[model samples]
Target chain A: MFDLEAVSAQWLGFTTEKMTAKYPVEHEPIRRHCQMVGNTNPLYLEPGYVEKTPCPPTAIPIFALPGRLPPDPKPRTTVLDIGLPVMGQGFTNMSREQEYLKPVYVGDHLAMQMRIVKLYQKPTRLDPDSLWIVTEDLITNQDDELVCLVRNTLLNFRTDEEWSATGVTKP
Target chain B: MSRQRYWEMVEVGEGMPEYQLEVTPTLIADQVSGSQDYNLMHHDRAFAQSQGAPDMYLNTGFIEAMLCRLVTDWMGDSGTLKKLGIQMRRFNTFGDKLTIKGKVTHKEMNAGEHLVYCDVWVESDREGVTVPGKATISLPSNQLNH
Candidate 1:
């Protein structure tokens, strides 16, 4: 049950070749994302309020997406699921758009690249057969500028008896 | 010391001034450990009811940082938020109470900034607009020579 035009003709225009951010913009993960969004907003908890803006353009969409931690734990893929092939387990997150051209201070160093601009396979009340994926993520820093631009809109699904009980086929 | 919002005193159906929060679980595990997105349906409510979700929810960078702290607490600290847009129809689970609303819906001035265009939302007293959004702020115009 997986042949949405040969998986969008091999991922429409697939892309994912730049991902750099081993560590740079710091300050306790932007104070743990403004204290888990309780956001005191003194331009992100006043580090002198606004003198060189210490960080808080809504912390640039959580450091422009970067996180994965678990000893040998790989199940939750992203970076637009590196090389898509849809085995659709189930996932959801319908939209997001962020643009913020510049503002991400502390130490800098951020980079990302991902693209698979769109794909829609209809029906979704949580998946009567859904598969709407749209990704963008352009974020850059460490002097290259281009601060942020995240587009994300994901929905992947699985049910046709979880796709024929994953007997897997269609490549 | 917040209080700036200028863009010539923004008006076009003005509203902005309604934000609330109360959905907890340590604010969803501090947004799943501050956005590392350990996605177990955002902290496993039995893995979000085994993916049929009836529990554990709220993550998309914590609803995009609570819709960027409800438009940066209503465009104050010299407003800039450039742009933000959201859509997730419903599912905010866990104690629910989120509020957050906005208005202004129009105002422009390109290249030189002074933007301001909103239409945010994120209701939840059980479900009303569980995240519907749009934003673009720049505001800071009192003719500072541009």
Candidate 2:
């Protein structure tokens, strides 16, 4: 058994500073990303497609690049860093919720910020020592408008018994 | 890609286009390169087996991309993807053919924009539903009906 308090105490309320990065919504990156997934959306492939579309060019790659996150810089704290306290040997991404607020057009710059919102432990019959780490990202276009709000929930499975000397039992 | 789908054109309960993709080593490698994800499991079979996995499997980042592809392919170029939510339930390893499907669950006019909602899911023979997702798409109105 692991010390629940020790693990919980180390990770709860642990947050990261807002880490920002500049991502340009360029045509090549957009096209390549779509191609990799075997997507044949002409709006993403054809020439002058953005201008020809019924919607504004801004909608061309709206909410694109998929959930290609965690590759980004975490600034002060890396939420996915295995080095973090109470970090587990196993990781499972349980869920993700994203809201696209504004359109991100090609040539527009994106100001992205990510931080760990909450960290807590939950008792499970399968793994009582698992920790749930939830992180959120706020992405804004160059115009300073919020483009998207993203939330990612992940489960960290830790089974090390070395840290249980405190005799913490599962709730 | 030739035809531009407009808001007035689509009907509620419409079935979006089905996307089928076979997960191959080269494709996964391409994704690893495209997403800048250098995880060994996505590329190294030996390392993955060493970690107790049956074989090298797909990464979460690629799944996200697949979800995006499912939504975007349905929305077309003119359609604005407003939201995407996905829950990864199973691991999609090599040689698995994923069939991504979705249907229009709801549609409404919000702030002069036609917002369409969809319930999306990814299935394979190995796993009935490897991933399930939801998405919101804003479409261009042809008649300008508010």
Candidate 3:
């Protein structure tokens, strides 16, 4: 059995290196990205509209990467390891919250920092044998302001017996 | 656009107007670019499949933003979104048709303000599975004095 308390304790005082990167708004990659998301709001694309509002729709809120963080052994996953399960396995992305304190233009540079906030465990009521582990991440900007917070829950069921024991029911 | 206050007439269990959106790679890419998310799983199909994603990429935070926008758009400027929670049950891939729907589930008076709880989700066009989530909004009540 995993030590719920011990694992929770590990999450405490758990910190990762502060990552800093600046993304120029004028980059073609940025423009292409804006076009891909289907945001027809001229504020993001039209340079003329940008001259008026000066703030692109792709700015601020979208610039905050929720789960962008360096890998830590404490959490036991790589950048690739993050996301929902493959086939038949159950995973739930609990929530993502963001707030924009300032505007970002096409040429503005955004600085980012990421850290682990918490880790906890819960049991599946449907399948007594299944345990669900959750991890929380906080991503902020250079000004030390919070941009977004993401909480992801991973369900670990090693076997069909465990899955059945956990009373796995499809929605 | 003039903002309208939603507090005048809203009841618990009232369904808000639905908004239909089409999700495409271009759309997903725009959101990803705006958000500065370079995760290949969201933009690159070959990478996503290598990582176990069914499709190339999916919209990240826009889903929640759209839901919040839905309420704010309906509530006009008078309502403020206080909290929003979402569960990404399945991947919303490129070129997927998404319908955002919500219903006011609960209402209460708090601290001289009218608070409404709404359950919302993005349903896949092919599969009806609702990405489960709920949001809370604080609106100026006509009866309540600020």
**Between 1 and 3, whose lDDT is larger?**
1
Span of ten consecutive residues with least summed lDDT in model 2 chain A? A54-63
Q: Write the per-residue lDDT of candidate 1 for residues B29-106, one digit (tens) a residue.
A: 788777777777777787776666788888877777777777777777777788888888888988988888889979
Runs of candidate 1 exceeding 4 Å displacement = A6-89, A98-117, A120-132, A135-152, A157-164, A167-171, B5-26, B29-44, B49-57, B65-67, B74-82, B85-112, B115-136, B144-146
For candidate 2, write residues A1-171 as lDDT tens digits.
445567556755555444344345666655666677875666666668743433222222232333344363211124544245644455556788877676666666665566667777775432566677787767666677877787888776643242253375523
TM-score of chain B of each: 0.37, 0.87, 0.89
Q: Calculate model 1's interface RMSD in Å.
A: 10.4
Model 2: lDDT equals 0.65
- How well does each candidate superpose onto the true structure, as a TM-score? 0.33, 0.77, 0.62
Q: Which regions of candidate 3 fall more than 4 Å away from where they truly are?
A: A1-9, A16-94, A97-171, B144-146
lDDT of 2 by residue, B1-146 (tens): 63567777878888877878888877877776555555565667775554335667776656667777767666665677777888877767788888888888888998888888888888987889988888888888888646
Per lDDT, the best of the predicted structures is 1
Fnat values, candidates in order: 0.59, 0.46, 0.24
lDDT of 1 by residue, A1-171 (tens): 577788788887787877776677777677788778777766555565434564666566556455553222333757335858763777778887878888788778788888888887888765665778888878888777888888888888763456456685412
TM-score: which is higher, 1 or 2?
2
Q: Best candidate, DockQ-wise?
A: 2
| Residue range A60-108, candidate 3, lDDT tens digits | 4444433432322222232224332222233324345443334345555
